[model samples]
Every structure is written in structure tokens, then in C-alpha cells.
Target: MSDSHPKVLLTGATGFVGGRLLPALLEAGLSTRCLVRSAERFRKPGTGGPGFETVEGDLLDPGSLARALEGMDAAFYLVHSMGGRSISRYRDYIDRDIRAAENFVRAADAAGVKRIIYLGGLGETGDNLSDHLSSRQMVGEILQSGRVQTTALRAANIIGAGGAPFEMLRYLVERIPLMVCPRWIDTKCQPIAIQNVIEYLLGCLLQPAAAGLTLDIGGPDIITYRDLMLIYARARGLKRVIVTVPVLTPKLSSYWINLITPVPAGVVMPLVEGLKNEVICKDNRILDLVPIRLIPMEEAVCMALAEISEGPGRIPSMQSCLIRDV
Candidate 1:
């Protein structure tokens, strides 16, 4: 690593995507710092060594965010309140998200952070947008409205081991020979592998084309939720049948998922409801900018499964996977 690398701050360093992203940033030779609510939770042995630091901070606490953003060239915003205490209703989550995003925007602006890179949910803006997806988009908009340049990457159904959505799909396919799915299963999505997602994030760091851009990122495959489950079954060499019924409401579907998979209803509801809207990528601008060999749906499934069986905290091999112009 060079001595003059850009200093970067990463929020949500303990979360699934952020956890993976922390190391990827380090591997890319950036001087990385993580803003975590609790330092102990993130400071495990053999991690955050030279060129990395962990700062105790909270997005809701502007003072902490200001301190964390000090002298940082860029920051990755990956924080969300999906299953917090005030989340009885979906709007509650939205309100909390808005509050946190506003605080981040103000603090980052005050500290003169150069750019804000955010990962938000994928969905078209419309009346039918679920509260979950709407909130995610709204956060991106709030970050973009700030003084700093913002690169918002909207993604759908990120396929990875131990990810909430992938775990839901994996457990459902593994445990059930036949599935009773809601109409949302037929809704189309472009699922990306976790490896590809990290690649895009790393590529955006110094890529001028990604600045001030709201890009949609995903794998090469456009698949439905039903197709995703079936693909997992095929990849795992399991036979399964999916029966899509229109009568199941999002509430009912969440409960169904809760009963079948280890994912709780609280976490499952928003994801299930969001599925009612198709989340396939409409823009391929990221392909031209990042230029990664997009993984296929089945191959992503296999990679995710391999990670799951191999245990946690391991990213797929990157020896031949990465090709960056920077």
C-alpha cells in the first residue's frame, strides 16, 4: 500500500455489506477508517491493523459524525434501521432513516467530505413503491442534495451467504420440497453477486464518471424471485416446486417466510413487500464505467452457497475477478 492513499470513512462497518466492504477498501490500498457505534463489536483480533482505524460514532449523533468525517476524502453510507425499537410500522423505519440521513448530510457537509457513496435499494419511483424501497431512495436523494458529490448505487436482491435475502431464499429452498409463494415471486429482479457489488463500490472510489450519478448495479441475469429460488435449487442439486398464488398478502407472506426460514417477520416483511415492484436495472451505465465481468445468476448462487458452507466472513477469490482502470 502507498503512503499517500486517500483517507476514507466507512459507516455501517458491522453490517453485512459494510462488513465485506471494509476489507475490500483496504485491499484497494485506500487508508480506511470505520465509524461504528461500538468499537468493541468491530475490533476483532487480526483486523483493523495498519492503515485502518475504528472510530466510535453514530449517524444520529452529529457531533460523532463530524468527528468521524474529519479529514476524510470520501465516505460510504451503508447504515439502515430495519429492525430497530421504533420500527413497529414501516413509516417508523422511514422516519428514522430520514433523520439519520439528514444528520449524515449535515455533518459530512460541515466536515467537507469530498464525496458520499451510498448503497440503496432498487425500485422505480412511483405510487406503488414500497415504503422500504421508497425510504432507501429517499436517503440517496437526501445525500445527493447535500454539498458533497454523491454516487448512489441502487441494487436488488444482493446474492451472498448470510445476507438476509439470500438466507431467506436458501432456507426456503433447502427446507421445503414445495413452496406456496405470493404473486410477488413473479416480480422480476436482477440479482447481483456480493463480489460484483464490492467491485462496483471499489471502482466508484476514484471513477469520475460515477460522481453525481445514481447508477443501478446488478448481475447479468434478470430473474424473478421464483426463478431465484429455483436457480438455488438447481445449483444445490435439489428438486423443488413453486406454486405462486395471488391471494397471499405481504403481511401473510412475511409470516409465511418467518415460519419457514430463520429470518424474522420484522425483517422479512419489508423485503417481501418490496418484491411487489420489479427491480431490474434499467441503466447499464455502470457496466461501461466499472467494466466487470458480470456473474450469471446460477454462478452467483453457487458462489453464495460455497461461502455459506465454508462458514462466514470469507469473500470469494479476487485474484482473476477484478479488472479496474484506476
Candidate 2:
């Protein structure tokens, strides 16, 4: 590894956001190493590249985490298992995340890693948050408790292909002509583009002010979940009618989501519950700090649909508006 670029240890390299971030980090001249449960996960076609290495490790295994964190400058903690079939119970997933964070923090501190960059969920702290959002915030707090400087970027629904949120909206609008939405669909949120998210994650690494900070990263538009489905429908050239019904419980909504969308019941339940709370960003300090143009909801939806049509490409470097963080 070269001494010029930071040696970054990236977890969740095989997951949606991490998979996109992996190449972006490398393109930004960072010396990258990924921590995966199995090294073979990176050996598939279009998954390998030069100037990056993979280490076999699991966040639950202290020994493996220690080995993985050795001689790393910073670590990107992007692991979450909300949608996994192995999560028998939602509460069990929360416990797993906390345990993993504890193990990772201990190992990172022992290895003398400088910082930890985390992507967490967005929602006001005392809003009777759902188990899924609560677990996300808890993991961020656990990461901050460690000796290393931690930067946790809390973001709302990310509009990107292959993401759970995007897939859910995509399937619902594409399959159903007239849909019955729950009351939670009216909850307000600031959905961001996946491209902008990568920019923020990369920006945090390059900005000294980002250390030991918890920032809200969101797109320009503030809209409800209902608006999101409508925007996605318009972008895909589909005409869909949505009617809100207050009688549907989270359990029933989850079953309906499973029947309509490819997302399973286990994943659908937590997500549907999370939609009950408003997740709009309360702060906009990231705009002044990072200086990238915020993509609007409609434009973001169109871009996401375009990505799905053209297939994935290397995420281009976002032109920075400010040369240095003030």
C-alpha cells in the first residue's frame, strides 16, 4: 500500500451501499482493504480490481476483527442485517448490531485506528423510534463511544437501485395500478441520491472538521413517502393511483408488501414500521462543509431509474464547490 493515501478498512463491501462505495474509495486514491466473512465473496465477476485487498473476517469474531483492523488508518462501518433471513426476530438483529459494534470498536481502538466512518438511519431521537431506526442510532452511538474519532452520517431513505427502499417503491408502483397506502406513507422524509451519499462518505474522509461529528445528510426536497412512490412512478413512466387507509397495521402492511413486492416479510415489517416516523433532516451543515450540489427528489428518481436501465458504472467524482472545509 502507498503511504500517500489513507489505508481504509471497509466493512459491508458486498452490500448495496458498500459495493458502490468500494470503487469510489479506490478511485479517490485511497488504499482500500475490505473485511468480509469470506474472501471468496469478492472473487465474483466484476467484483475485483487492482489496488485493493480483502481480509477474511466477521464483526462478531473479535480475533478476526482484530486481525482485520491491524495497521488501518480508518474503518468504514456499513454492516447491517435487517433484511437477512438469519434474523429470526427483529430484536435479535438489534442485539447483533450492538455486539458487532462493540467488537469492532474494541479492535479498532486496540489497533490504533484514527477514525470510524458510519452511515446511520435518520430520525429524531425521542420520536418513539421503531426498532430498526433505534438499532441504527444505537450502533452509531456505540461506535462514537470508542477511542477512535467517529463520523456518523445519518441519512433518510436513499433513492438508488437495489436498495430495499428503492426496490419496494419500484415493485409497488410497477405492479399495482391502484394502491392502498397506510397512514405512515404520509410521514415526511428527505430522500437522497446514492451518488450524493458516496460523495458525503468520501467528503468526510477528506474534511478535518468531520471528525467526532454526527451530521445529517439529506437531499434538497422534503416530501412524504407517498410523494416518493409517485415520483418514482412518474420517472418510470407509470401512472399509479394511491389511496391512504388508516386501518392497516404494520403487520398487515408487511404482509401486503411481501405479496406485492419482492421484499420478504422479515424485512418488510421493520421498514413499514420505520415509515411511521418523520425522518426529515434537522441540520444542513453538510452543505456548507462538503459543497456538492444537492440533488432534488425528482432528479434523483430519474437518475436512479437511468442507472437501472444502463447498468452500473464507476461512480464519477463529484465536483467540489469548495476547495477546503472551513
Best by TM-score: 1
Report the lDDT of model 1 for residue 75.
91
Q: Report RMSD for candidate 1.
A: 5.7
Residue-level lDDT tens digits of model 2 in 206-234: 88788889999999999988888888888
Off by over 4 Å in 1: 1-4, 43-47, 84-91, 313-326
lDDT of 1 at 70: 93
lDDT agreement of model 1 with the native: 0.81
Give stretches of model 2 more than 4 Å off: 1-4, 43-50, 86-88, 311-326
**Cα displacement (Å) at residue 289, model 2:** 1.4
